[model samples]
Target: MNNNIVYKNVNLKEFTSCKTGGPAKYFIQIDNVDDLINTLDSAKKEGINIFVLGGGSNVLINDNGFEGLVIKIQNKKLKVVPTMDDYFEIAVGAGWNLNNLIMELTQQSISCLEDLYGIPGTVGGSIRGNCGVTNFEIKDVVSKVYNLDWLRFNDYNFEIKTYNQNECGFGYRESIFKRKANIIWETNLVGKKCNETIIKEKIKNIMDKRLKNQPYEFPNSGSTFKNVNLNEFDSNIWNSENLLVVDCEHRQQVPAGWLIDQCGLKGFSINGVKISEKHANFIVNFDNAKSLDTFNLISFIKQKVFEKFGVHLELEIQLIGF
Candidate 1:
């Protein structure tokens, strides 16, 4: 471990939303670019595998502890700058919590992402996943992303480069960052403005719906898959008139939750790991759940869904550890 980095023999359960996983050989809570670069160098020198962890909202880890270094980002800061009428951009640190950031922004009458109501993880994680709700996604608002030049570590210490929306290949829950691994330091968000009272009311409506529909009592990541064509119409869901409704869309978008529910996966459990009863899309911790249990249940869902529907469900979460 690097003298500059801190942490050792730490359990990953506490950090992850699923509350699963074993201990990590080395761990560091990073707050800035320097710390990230230093830790990357140290990991390379030690010849250990590296896993960059955010809030652990959208991922599952192996029960066996990692034999490598894990870096958890925590640097969160925001700078609000005005650009145009009812338009503003925010330079945000990677570590900022997703919901809290939205809440703060909504309070300021900025409301581009009000519909993306409930999501887990950090801003960087959301960017990595291109998280969205309904038809809106983070990719639409991302003006630029700042990250290290290389995948692991850069001996040349590559300077941060910025890319506009065109360079990032973004689709439902997937982005260029999803395919690439690097330390993301900041992102510039372009948002819309509204009346303060109206924005707050909209946010309240969204939150109220969330509290009524989604379970907030226990920890769990949001939905599990991007819609696919193969698994569409399992229960006559898209049986409307001619148009696709995500429409003109020849491709079908399948919802994994509906399938899981059909497969009797709701409230399914493997030890302490349990699929959320309220929302089949969520996986919850039922007291000291181990990583393996979570892994097993997820596997079980996939197997059954595949057997019945002949389509595979892709994961929305990133897996880090063992």
Candidate 2:
């Protein structure tokens, strides 16, 4: 049998969208189910820490590199199987590009992913992160999740299963995957069929709105903070009579953009990282902007916002290494 494991130091910057990260001790690509099992088993045997890297879009890695192995999910395919009564179950590999998958699904009349067009990263990343705007996360439609337990891919002994959103423990940008750190091999998305042209048009509208607001050209995580809740967050905001009625009605989910912009942080900068002059929520790398640059910018925003508004900003981007 051909050996699929790679033992080398991988420059994570090349794989990450931010264009800056240190290096990984070991990098492995799992192209199929068999490959995934093999890679995981080898890592376990060697007593190496495992980090599954999916499109590398919504994270900033430290400049010092990861101490464990980085497994890049390279298996890409979307299989459409016909179900009863004009329905279809789409099996999407975790390695698939999220945008491309959405676009293709829209073209083929898939209804669920239309509003999720502009989100970056991969199928598994989105699933694991539970990414979405407000209440429209990807886990909303997940039917059954397939997982490989203990890196055993060859046989069914190491397999595990979870069904639906409740089992997934999906919350605001969180799931069991964050704690368990297991593999999401594929997803069975059961969605209704719609007119292909209409689906495409809707996706285009939502996607265009996203592009117009966010800076797509620059390398940065989409949003820096998860909005704090009104009831569960810091208790100080409750007695304030000046809180926006809209914010109050929504309970805790305030838009990070509004809060950041309100703090006059749109053009804020530190070193080469600046809160994208276009969007307050985005912190971009201006040429020589390294991981440290973004880190400092985030720090400035957090500090300033807390001092000015008394609300701490919880980051949405996954910060690794440092």
What candidate 1 gets wrong by more than 4 Å, as runs, is 1-5, 230-251
lDDT of 1: 0.74
lDDT of 2 by residue, 44-121 (tens): 777888888898988999988898988888768688887887678888888888888877877777677766788878
Error of 2 at 20 (Å): 1.4
Candidate 1's displacement at residue 240, Å, is 16
Candidate 1 C-alpha RMSD relative to the actual structure: 3.6
Q: Give the lowest summed-lDDT range of ten residues in model 2.
A: 241-250
**Per-residue lDDT of 1-322 in model 1, one digit per residue for the tens?**
3334668888887888777778888888888777677777767777878887887888777778778887887878788898987789888888888778888887788876666666667888888788876657888788988876446456675566686777767776767776766667788999888776887787688788877766678767667555556435445433431223242134355566767877888988888768888878777787777766767777898899778676678777766653
Alpha-carbon error at 137 in model 1, in Å?
A: 0.8
Winning model by TM-score? 2
lDDT of each: 0.74, 0.77
Q: Supply candidate 2's per-residue lDDT for 83.
A: 88
Clashing pairs in 2: 229-252, 230-252
